[model samples]
Target: MGDTLIDEPTDLSVRLATVFSQMTRVRTFRLMNSAERGPWPALLKAVFTTPSLTCLEIWESPWRRPEEKFTIEALELPQNYSSLQRFVYRVPFSDCFPRESKSYGRRDRVQGSVELSNLRVLASLICDSVEVLELPAELAFLLTHITYPKLRVFSVQGHEPLQLAEWAEILRSARQLREVHLQTPIGFTEWSKTSSNWIESNSIPTAPVPQTHSDDLIMRGLSNLESLTISNPLDPGKELFFQFLPYANLRTFSLKAFPPLSALGARWSGIHSQVLTSSEILCILKGIQLINLSTFEVSYSVDAEDGVMLSHISSSFPSLEKLEIHRYRSLAKYNSEYDPLVSMPDALATATNLQHLMLNLDFPERPYWRDDNLNPERYKVFHGFLESQVASPFTGAIPSLKTLGILCHDAFSSYWDTWEVSKTRKLVSRPPHAMSN
Candidate 1:
């Protein structure tokens, strides 16, 4: 299939099927970064014929960002199209409806605008079996159209905030969803709204719908989730996520902390990124209280004062086996831009079961004690604390620990002996890296 040209292939699906049938363990089929849109018919045929394939990833030309054209010729699928488990489909769309539906959203559009037929066809085929779904914003609408009983992990791309009702319906269908990851949220934006104007002049729904039903449906579905991740969220409008704060089974949570609210753009929502607002911290505490999490990861961009937060983390999540608190872009060039971190080593000693810990924190090579206009004594104490606080309880306290990892930075090399002279385990200069939290 990779060698065959667009017109050179003949009965491609049959040949590909014959080849793939012999290899039982071959699960992933990916066609990414192609300079040209490789023979769509042959590609589709090959995909449709793979019975054992678990993951399918298809991306448009990596360098091409053209006005998307709905060129996929819709084909009839068999009564049963099952085996797929993961699918990542990223393609722009225009305003077009499905043939099976009576009314598609009243989206106004252009002639070459992408349609939903191609995406709908792909989704409908794998609706019953796919467990993990990642789609672009345009096809988020299709989430409501399919019912995936085994679906456990879901993620969405594009900047649009999903329609609450449609999203609730999707969640209701995915009763097994264990994790939900949302990235780069845009408040009050929809695929149709961003792509084009409305086809109908009257954009209002005549009937008043109850918002509580959506919330109820969403919360009920989230009770089964075990993990959740949100990255680069704009502040101001994140009502749906706050609703997920009290998940029943959520044990692992991951969030990316960005600059403070002062850095937000005009269009951005008010997300408490820096020093995570008290409410956000409360949510984390609630998650810790509600579930006995085995792992949790948090990424800090600018300011993550490790004082009370570490104490809270130390006290909460006693069952935590893996914990990661990463701070990147750590230099003093933006000294005013970020709040300095307080070294509170004793605060993290409470996690009794922790085995693997990765905290990308480092002390300055040259400890300069300077007085500040605000909290002059507090700032001086913290600076002195950073210079002196290197003793960590990663060994004896965490008896189950084996591996410890941190970003290699200058000045923090003295802690090497602390890990090297451990009672049972050795401090590692470098170890096999694990996935980011």
Candidate 2:
């Protein structure tokens, strides 16, 4: 049946444009192929209807009738979501299309490409105004050609590390970017050179090193960058890791400190047996002078000296509001399974401005989800970890703390979490603006 929007246009392009124009109020759209129906043009039309829509998600089915061919790029999309703020598109990589991966079973549905003919148009339109964007790792390069002047939060999925120079060059214009996250956990590998374990190797051709960033250059360039996260582990002492510190406005920062990787690269390498230490923290803080720094998070293990480190953190950012110390891969091959978190540092007690605190500690009691019996011995361990050792400092360190989050066994015990929270909350005093203030 011919619809009014189509105006009985004989040309397929005109008909599709007609559908897109009529989608005036449609804001949230999901573009995907389903087994019950092949949403040829109707589902795709959902792309343009909403001018005021703020969120859009696009996904493609991995299992489809092998013989069925799906095409997405039917026309040069003419619409743009100038007001769109968040866009999540998990398009299958090119390799996944037209060919089934080893993981796909024999009973798997047909494989085909979501030939969104003009993906560039979609990327261009959203890239302009999107503040928080999560897109396929395959299409992340599209950001290179487009400018996200308003982009504030960005995350890419692919494992490949964006070269330091390329990342810096592209972000040169993203002055408003407060958070830049790279979420490549599995497919990515990082081999960084630390000052302690650096051994210059000549076997691998490493990416060229980026030029050093001076104080003036860093401040003037990415001054607004605050929170940065990367799934790929980092070398704390490496120059690339330090290059991100110019954000005078930095408040929250998280990085996964991975062990030295033996990748195909030529740089100094050393036997790093330590987790991120307080010394590394001080080094970074000293350079950036992040007076407003609030939350500092690191993954992986840590070096000794919890006392001196925590003390510096309190003095460094008196305005600190939140502090988090999570053990990244607390258990690994070379890492021990019985490994426990470091004892609460006494220095933490001095973070007067701290409001929210999260620590990876061994909690008391057992989780209800599992069949394991409650360990009575955990009682001593929990209190000893939180109270006897750093009772005075821990309670006094963050007078402003409203929430104390802890991950025991690097997980949660629904049964005990509620009580632990209540117990800890009462032990710590609240600020004098206490109830009303």
Candidate with best lDDT: 1
lDDT of 1 by residue, 24-82 (tens): 67788877545333325445656666666788876532112223332335343464465
In the range 1-437, model 2's lDDT, one tens digit per residue, is 11223121236545655676676776676545332322344434444554557776655332233222333344235556356787765432323212233221111112222222234445667776778876543345434546777878876543233455546544654556778766443331333222112111211233443466433433444567777765444422234545646656777766543222211121211212234545555555566566777777654344554445566777877778867664433233332223433334445666777776655432223222222355545544554444433333455445566665544331222221211123454544222110000
User: What lDDT does the true structure give each of the candidates?
Assistant: 0.53, 0.46
Against the hidden true structure, what lDDT does model 1 obtain? 0.53
**TM-scores of all candidate predictions against the true structure:** 0.67, 0.59
The residue ranges of model 1 lying beyond 4 angstroms of the native Cα positions read 1-18, 59-76, 90-115, 185-209, 232-237, 257-288, 301-305, 328-344, 362-400, 408-423, 428-431, 434-437
Worst ten in a row by lDDT for model 2: 195-204
